[model samples]
Target: MKQPTTDISSQQAEQLLQPINQFLQCRTPASWIEQAKQPQSLPILLKDHMVCELKAAQSAMLLIRRYAVDEDSGNALLQWLKPYEDFTYRLKGNWRDLADHNKLNKRMVPKSTKPYSQELIDKMVLLIKEELHHFYQVLEIAAELGVSYDRITSSRYARGLFTHVRTYEPAALVDKLICGAYIEARSCERFAAIAPHLAPNLGQFYFSLLRSEARHYQDYLSLAQQISDTDINPRVQFFAEAERALIESPDSDFKFHSGAPV
Candidate 1:
């Protein structure tokens, strides 16, 4: 199969991702990324990445509820995720909730045909499943390393992009889709940037994430275009600038999505 054009040459990807790479290099003290390459860094990175997976799943669920699903389906989604959220928020849940043996293989039923399309459902479901799988993988890595899971404060990256979203309903959805594109794009870019700096196992893992991340960005952009009747170039450009600003800014936190190191 021919690869998509979105999968740019490594050189092109490097050039496009330079800004984020530079920001990470500037913000992350050299000692940190270097240490992260070590076996000891595995526990911390794995634990944090585990949390990131849950957050990613949560984000996808929010999007599906907000834009794709009708009221009934939205409620169903909330119920489906309640156990995971309870655990994440440190609330007690049933033993089944804690077991981690349940697999997310069920199909989602749309409440309304007006907003929900099969294509949209398929893409979002795939994204949600992958995110959840990544969550499980991170948990496995953490368990292997004897790392106790703990919740930490979220970085400002997501909020920064979301703050630009319009307050109106559909417009807000459009803006959010654009923002989602940028987030996925940046994640793909970062996976490439940090891949070479990581140890063999980690390097392979980051590389493996790149193809999916790139597809995710394209999926968001495609959805935005489908929802909007007209061309979405302006919206894309608007969010690209916003994303670049966020990437270039200085931030105190050193998360996977944080700005330049301070």
Candidate 2:
């Protein structure tokens, strides 16, 4: 079960972030922190963050759709995401209207879990719900901050991690889950690293996100371990190194998960 988000003190934040910090290969680089906290950066920050929340929801949906769910369940999942996609992609919907569409209209019935387990569906379904909720919260904050939503190009961080995934069955899924773990872990690290520098409410909002995202990291790791037929230590190490390089190296792009600014 997941823990609820509540007000957390600096000391509590430190305690919450301890495991995430250790799991990540390195801290958010000082350069990135400086860049992120600038007055002009908030819109871009919220814009990209809003986009990312939607993307995270999409990713989790696709995971269960491809590997776990039946046709009706998969279609329902797509419908759940449609409003946000329309707002972002087609610019055809109101943000306020999106709140009405953030739930699964019907039950998500899983199909045969051959390459994966029921836990994958269980964890990912919860993840999809939370990520979509976060998407809505980001829209609320962006609206309050007077930041309008616009599409932005994705950073190399996720694609760079995916480039190394094995093409084989179960291994591919396992690798993807490991990648998910690292992504969630890095998000927790970055939110902790940057929250204090944001506006009070925004900082608190970011802190509130830490609990769920940390659980997401753990869930992804657990699913990866469950799916792997072999000991996943070496594979986990492999992605850890890959993830470290992505976090620590310099990059020209600046997204939430981008490397140090070049």
Candidate 3:
């Protein structure tokens, strides 16, 4: 196959992804990219990718509602997400139905006067919007390829990272944000790693996502720092090592974010 010229060169990609690569413990194995490029992987990849995007938005919504927004704003946030979640979780609607309602209902109001609260709401709301748009784009790609949106079980990739989260107030939130950074970073890394090997249309789509995903990681890291009373380096290193293991280790099943094949 003639590869598309849309890909960033390795050096450029490396430079673009360096901040993320430095934060992660291990690089994705070339074997995973090889496997991901095969004809058989498209359906599951798109399906899980769609889910991941929606999950990203949902996670951002949760963060805002829990730590930033007031009760009414939180409720408004949920209402904003309902249609997308309903389509994803309940199979209640299609991409066009979602397309009809593209805007969030209202801006979130901070639950407190804390400096970080409004910052969190602003950054996360934009993140949520971008994520939902990405979700819709993935669905469009799947539809174009005649792939059905089958519900696959969640990958261990996210669960493994979440398990290490501390179970207390600011620590818990800090850890969660760190995990979010790792997740977004990994996604950006994988997008760059695999884009060159995909079909032209898919390659273009994946390439288009690199910038937003990179920003998402940076935003997560910044938010974590802003919310933390102390340096989060130790916590960041902990999650980096953990996420590295999750990516580099053998896995029994293939997933959008799964480790190298066994």
Candidate 4:
């Protein structure tokens, strides 16, 4: 995988992915990459990818809304996502309307009481911005390639990880952030693994995503560590095992993060 040459050198790409490669338990199986590049899978891939971008943004927004922002800011965040939600859920809006709604008003007042959680406001807010922008970019890519965005189901990857989330407090938040790290790390891995096999433009797009997704993994990990009162190493290891199982086990649903195809 030495391409994405226009954006960065292969040596740089390898260096960029080194931490992500070290973090994850396995490489994406060649079969999965082959599956992803199939012509029949392209529309499904683009549609689900578009949804994933929105979902990523939504999760980041939820973190800021529930744990960091003032109520008004939370409401503002909701409105920011409404157009996207409407399109995904109700099929009510067009892609053209989405861009106008991506920006959050400068009213994200931090809560004085939850000083620690306030840290989430900045990182998660940046994630929200970039992810929503990604959602738009994916929509454009899909349209350009004549792929129609439609209703698509999720793979078991995220649900499987979330099942391990603790039924408790900051611990739960820590677990969620850990899960976020794995998800981001895996996305980064898959993007690199499959990029070389895609059309040049799409390959470049996926390649361009590598740095941000890698940074997202690190950000999620740092947040998990920062928010945890106790050592998060054991928990991180625990989730790593869980994520590994999800990635290596047999799976029928094939989406961006699905494991082995049945």
For candidate 2, lDDT tens digit of each residue in 124-174?
989988988888888888887778887788889889999999998889998
Write one digit per residue (lDDT tens) for candidate 4, span 32-128: 8888988888787788887888888888888888888788999999988888999997889778878798788766888887766667888888888
TM-score per prediction, in order, is 0.78, 0.95, 0.93, 0.95
Q: Where does candidate 1 stray beyond 4 Å? A: 1-44, 91-107, 111-116
Question: What value of lDDT does candidate 2 attain over all alpha carbons?
Answer: 0.85
lDDT of 4: 0.84
lDDT of each: 0.65, 0.85, 0.85, 0.84
Off by over 4 Å in 2: 1-5, 113-116
Tell me which residue pairs clash in candidate 3.
Answer: none
List RMSD in Å for every model shown: 5.9, 3.0, 2.7, 2.6
Once fitted onto the true fold, the runs of candidate 3 whose alpha carbons sit more than 4 angstroms away are: 1-14
How many steric overlaps does candidate 3 have?
Answer: 0
Model 3 TM-score (2 dp): 0.93
Give per-residue lDDT, candidate 1, residue 92: 55
**Reference-based TM-score, model 4:** 0.95
